[model samples]
Target chain A: MAEETSPRGPERRRGDALLRAIHEAALAELAEVGLGQLSMEGIARRAATAKTVLYRRWSTPHELLVDALHQAHPVEVPTPSADDLRTDLVAALKLLTDWMGTPAAGAVLAVMTERHRYPELAEALYSRVFDPRGGTFTSTVLRHYANAGTLDPRRLTPIVTQIGEALVFKLTLDLNRLPTDEELVAIVDEALLPALGFPLG
Target chain B: MAEETSPRGPERRRGDALLRAIHEAALAELAEVGLGQLSMEGIARRAATAKTVLYRRWSTPHELLVDALHQAHPVEVPTPSADDLRTDLVAALKLLTDWMGTPAAGAVLAVMTERHRYPELAEALYSRVFDPRGGTFTSTVLRHYANAGTLDPRRLTPIVTQIGEALVFKLTLDLNRLPTDEELVAIVDEALLPALGFPLG
Candidate 1:
């Protein structure tokens, strides 16, 4: 846990504060004007920062948008010690659904759609926002299951990653509904537990 | 088959021919001028149709785009058979991946994202395209599984729907990769088959 902290707490705190301000400004602008109308000048004004400051940090509006998005959707790492895999997965899935249903979720997704035209934004999005949050939690859960002898070691990462990805995908693309409690339980019983070689049914 | 043909033939043929001209023109415009630059006037000019014709059929660029998308992506409903669940799922997942990875997929996704601004367009897309293609396939597959005694009778439509939705969700939202063969197999082993009370793994 100590290693997770920055060596210079004051510097890190300052950076985090700046990032938070930028992120909140981005969100406000997006909600008010929509993604197509979001401008760096508007965000800067909302944040009470100079356009120079924004330009100094990010080369373009796209980069600034991506950075703000990354800050708003910081990576989430699941803590996997909830007694059993099912309980841990339910908690994790619930968190994911909550995030997806948030205002930030729509903002992030809008940026993703825009990523088709700007491929670099896709890489930034994947590396900064998605990979850290979803990717880390997925790996942590699979690793815990393997260590507990609940999951087959060989298939652990791929199975867990796909399940996590699928949950997020459903909310973003099709259905557009948050995962229900029953659906979450089904995922645990039918997918997560069995992937760990547990007899679920 | 006769009934299916009756409603879908002459009307469909005429509709398709008109749609084909519009689609080809749209595609050419998209390639030449890009999505933001696309207009009904340009599409009509390229297709040799009046702008009024385009407007009569579709009210907005998004509507025309959706129609163009449906024309490009004809739904393929899988015939339910008593085949092994693993085999059936793999075939189905393959079709999904192929469609998502096609050239038109990005364009269609763009329209879906734009639909957020137009709720009516979003609803039309949901009923006309998304439901009939992905949603219908999911129900059909689940039904086959239930009848064959491969799925748990307790597992209802929503749960089965989640499983299907997740597969596409993962590809479009998170991993940006299609599910591999192993993943298709694992989904059945862990999620679908077990939820339905079928023994997998």
Candidate 2:
């Protein structure tokens, strides 16, 4: 355990610190060069480490990228405060907006946007990062409410679960900007909650 | 009027016929070369026409491409069959699916997917094509129902009008396939109708 420590200083990161730096470097490299041009040597160079160090942890840049995205994937925490489905759903989408502003999000977008050219990498992304991280933002929150008996389990169909994220994407595509807080609230009130069989006034 | 006739047995096109040929060639050319590489020379070559003929009507490839998308854009016909909201909504989304199968859809996708790279083209698409064509597949149908005093106009907010198209785009992005008829029906029954104030059994 003592050997794991960097005796010199913070200049030489070790253990979890080293791993985090490598992950961040992978994402940054992906953003700069895109998925088609991602290379282990490039990532190692960006991380200021040796290619041997990266190969010790991951076989290929694809493996390292998936791990980077998985580490950066957000997990929703459904609040138990008064069983507020609206607040929870909004907060979950807020997490998505926050994540969208990250370097990992750009990496993920590059992979998805050019998925046809990199099918294997795209497949790894879904299997390793998205699926293992509860599929989507509102999905975890919806499942939590369903478990709490606050929402009808049957109402949480695939179409219903996809509403929030879908509209967010559509709105973004149309407006060329992230949805404001009020727009997010309108999404919950107008589309998502209604599909969940909530009474609309 | 005599001069307008094609004397060489359809070899020399003119007027609306020639205009349509140019439009189709533009869409095909956009799909082949993408937005950045689209040009009058390529479109005219594909259409077997002179560049001067194209210049007479349109200023640039962007202008011609937008016009092609507009011309090829589907207009919804809301059938007045027994005031059936479910059937009409499904039919509307079906129009979207059909449009998706066309070359124009690929052209549109190329522009949208690379909107940041060519912001003016994207802007022209919305203002000239999408907005002028009722905005979305279900938007026209929603307005029809609202006008017929069948659906509450209050229910046809921007979010509500967007639900059908939003889900369609989202499903296509996730599944990488067009939504089948059964899936479209599910969208109507599970999401659209419920939001439009129809009771779910």
Candidate 3:
């Protein structure tokens, strides 16, 4: 812990601030060098911290990455005002899109794209980051609505839970851009809502 | 064209046979070296043909790669038996999964994954491969059913057309394997069917 204290005196990063910087650095390093080349040395260098400091917290780059991803993963707040399923679902996906704009999202993509080459990393990401946070993007909102007796729980199947994130990923991959507000609404109207037992007539 | 005659006597690749070989080689080469490093030299070497032979049919690797993808892209066949939408939709996604198992699929993914770095190649993929083939996997089936008056044409929105492929991609990414037949059926029943106005009671 001696090297944890920066030589730069008053500008030294510590506590939650230091953890956040380290997490950000890990993600940035991953984006720059990819999963194969990600190392504690590189992350430490990027964070302007000593390898000893990283070693104190995480045994390997994989562990540090899992921590970073979990720390950065956004927990969706399902605000079901007046029992509004559509608005809440849209807001959940909006949280997802907003997260997609962050550096952490890019890092997550890098890990996922190379998941086959590194199975343990992908597994750790799910257990540490995604699953603990309530599965996919719109899943929390769906569950909230279901619990409120507004939406059918049976309709909240695995396929239904994944619809929002799946479509978001598909649109992003196809368009090479985040889906627009209008497009998000269309996903809600055309896809998500109907799957929840609300047919389009 | 003189060098088009193989030095290996009776094993000479020429005409359509030669063209097919060249296309396959281009896709294989792209898979091996990726888009940035793809070259006529590598493709010709892999195809066991001269660079001159390659240049005779196509000017550059991009042109040759596009041709390869177009040649390999699968056309969905919708057999609407007794006006059945479920069977046709399932078969369409089956075609998609089958295509996903091919080398061409890998080559297409390679291009798409790095689409930003190689925008022109990505654009060529859509124009020459996807759009020309019928937009997406389930779209053709949806249209066929729509024309037969079995499905509501208005229900065939972009979001609806994408549900099958999107769910497939999502499942594959999350599970690190292609969706099983059971999973595909789930997608159709729980997501696609409902979205197309066939909600489960």
Candidate 4:
């Protein structure tokens, strides 16, 4: 225990801190000039670290962005409690908008554009980001309701899991702006819940 | 009857034919090179028509494209039959996918990118393209079902009208490709219909 804490423990903590700084810098730069114009030297200069460290860790900005996007917290999507359908949907969609609004709009666009040039990156984003965060939440929440007989068992399918996330992504990308709270509420109350067979009071 | 067959009537028919030729040329060119790089000269060359005619009718490619996007349709969205929600959603989504796949994707991107530079153009596309087609279909169809007691009356709202259209526009933009038939059916059956509270069985 003594040796564990004495030297390398503090060094490990410093290494993690440096990595965070580099990732933050990379995201900031991506938001500014976009993916095509991004440079390792520029990120290094902005990060105040050696260029060698960035090159060693990531051979390309695309690789670095895949890592950086994970840390950028567009917003946190939480698993639903056994709440009723309306409240559960509202809560889920709210998290989506929060994430949409968190990053600079340019940051998202840059990644979207890069995905066209790089298929592996697109697949990575789907696996790492899209699926884990929003995918399971809907199923878990809906299953809870289904078990209670609030929703039909057949309604608990892949479609239920994707509607809110798809809407948020679609609205943000199409409108080229994040939806306001009023818009989000209307989307949930007027559309999402009713479709899920949750008769609104 | 004699007046209907006058020389002027034949001239008007030719004029309409010319207009269609121009619109076709514009869409073809837009599909090839996209909105940004599209030129009147290029469209004229492709259509085997004169540049002066294009200039006289529509001064810019943007104006030409605005007209062309309206005409390039495999089918129009009709009011939903009371047959079932699954068929109605699939039909609506099919129309959406056709539109997305029509013009070269660059055409959509060009206009989307231009929305920031020209708010008036964005407003024009919304008023002319989006609202008339997808917007009205949802309300008209939902009201059709609701009147028959197949769907809840409250499900008839602007958000309900828009969810499938929103999802299609969003997926095409984000993925940079249109969804296939099987995927489209899955989206409609698995998600769209169920969300509207339509019983799957």
Question: Best candidate per TM-score, number?
Answer: 3
The global C-alpha lDDT for each of the candidates, from Candidate 1 onward, is 0.66, 0.83, 0.83, 0.65
- DockQ for each candidate? 0.23, 0.32, 0.44, 0.21
What is the per-residue lDDT of model 1 for residues A22-109, given as tens digits with 9 covering 90 to 100? Answer: 8788877775666656788989899877788787787776677777676666535578977677788777777767776776777777
Q: Model 2 chain A: which ten-residue window has the lowest total lDDT?
A: A73-82
Q: Lowest lDDT 10-mer window, candidate 4 chain A?
A: A4-13
For model 4, residues A34-70, the per-residue Cα lDDT tens digits are: 5555789889888878799898899987778778876
Native-to-model Cα distance after best TM-score fit, residue A106 in candidate 1, in Å: 3.4
**Each candidate's chain A: what TM-score?**
0.69, 0.76, 0.79, 0.73
Off by over 4 Å in 4: A1-21, A32-57, A73-75, A104-114, A126-137, A147-150, A173-176, B1-89, B109-154, B169-177, B180-201
Pairs clashing within candidate 2: none
For residues B119-171, what per-residue lDDT tens digits would candidate 4 score against the true structure? 66667776777666544444556667778887877655556556776666556
Give per-residue lDDT, candidate 1, residue B131: 70
Clashing pairs in 3: none
lDDT of 2: 0.83
Q: Provide the TM-score of chain B versus the true chain B for each model in turn.
A: 0.66, 0.76, 0.80, 0.70
- The true-structure Cα RMSD of candidate 4 reads 9.9
Candidates 1 and 4 compared: the better one by TM-score is: 1
| C-alpha-based local distance difference test score of model 1 | 0.66
Q: How well is candidate 2 docked (DockQ)?
A: 0.32
Q: What is the lDDT of candidate 4?
A: 0.65
Candidate 3: tens digits of C-alpha lDDT, residues A1-201: 365556557686688998999999999887666665689999999998899999999999999999998888774555555567888788878888987878888878867866765779888987777775545558877877788888879888888899999999889998899999999999999999999988765
| Residue A118 C-alpha lDDT in model 4 | 55
Docking class of 2: acceptable
